[model samples]
Target: MTMPAFVKPRQVIGHHLVLRDATPADAEFIVALRTDESKSRFISKTSSDVSQQVAWLEKYAQDNSQVYFIMEDREHNPVGTVRLYDQQGDSFCWGSWVIREGSPSGYAVESALMVYQFALSLGFTRAHFDVRKGNESVWKFHERFGAVRTEETELDYFYSLSREAIDKSLAKYAKFLPGGIQVIAA
Candidate 1:
């Protein structure tokens, strides 16, 4: 199904930032973001060449099971991206990588909000993600959203949360978010 244009365009956040879908045109930026040493280390993936990135973006654009969005700053500069994929039944997987390198305040919050919105749009009962084993900061961040660790491997830690849990957690933190940050489902 085709998403509405309003939802497809830039989603504003308190007049400071926007979140929107990524395109094949974002290949260069995505390559750079993926290559950043710190980000790469945590994500456990190597950077792709421009051609490879373009191909990957093409595949993503054609895949209904995945949605990727680019986060832009006030000036409309693309700074980072988040991806939601692997939808099956009521379960889906999510992943995010921010390569803004000293981004403004609330970037992480914005990313989390996007994840919540996407999961809801997909009608997912639960969303899951994995953080590298040593990425304590990210693990704690997920915990703050009420995500519980369900599995721990030598290399990564897995976290999952039900739809009810996500909604309750969002409600619990609503007062802390910026005004106009609506969670829209597809």
Candidate 2:
């Protein structure tokens, strides 16, 4: 089976931000982003050690099923992180998403559309993700895309989106991501 290219985007650019694959050079920043108390509550992993962070990056480097991204504003300042991983046939997962406090309101929304576009561009038919049950903000964000909650873990709510739903959501949000979606830029 063919893996999706969003796993390692050279650079998925949109109106408000750029999403690129994570590298060892980003270890410190990734650590800080993932550990911030505000962001850590909803995340499953909270280890703050940089060496361990780099080790995780190294392992991800070899995993075709995962793609970790560093999100930056057009001015090139790191603002967030997200990942698309856990491919099972034509479906995959997207999450590990976090944005800094006080970012422009639309960055998260547009960045998510970029992720869905990248996944659909790879011909994948479904996208799955989990949100901690109490993370109302993130949960609502996913809901806007017409995601349906398919399961509930003790600590999280699992949501899935059909390709058709994603495509439709993209249209609803296209104005926010001007230039459409060039998900894979060679």
lDDT of each: 0.71, 0.84
lDDT score at residue 124, model 1, on the 0-100 scale? 62
The TM-score between candidate 1 and the true structure equals 0.83
lDDT agreement of model 2 with the native: 0.84
lDDT of each residue in 2-120, candidate 2, tens digit only = 65544465888888888888888899998888888878987887677899988988888887778788999989999999888888778889888989888999988888888887777
Candidate 1 wrongly placed segments (more than 4 Å): 1-15, 180-186
Q: Which stretches of candidate 2 lie over 4 Å from their true place?
A: 1-7, 183-186
> What does the lDDT come to for candidate 1?
0.71
lDDT score of residue 149 within candidate 2: 97
TM-scores for all predictions: 0.83, 0.92
Residues 43-155, candidate 1: write the lDDT tens digits: 75645679888888888776766778887876879988877776656667778657478887677766676567545654566778898878888889889888889999999
94, model 2: CA deviation in Å?
0.4
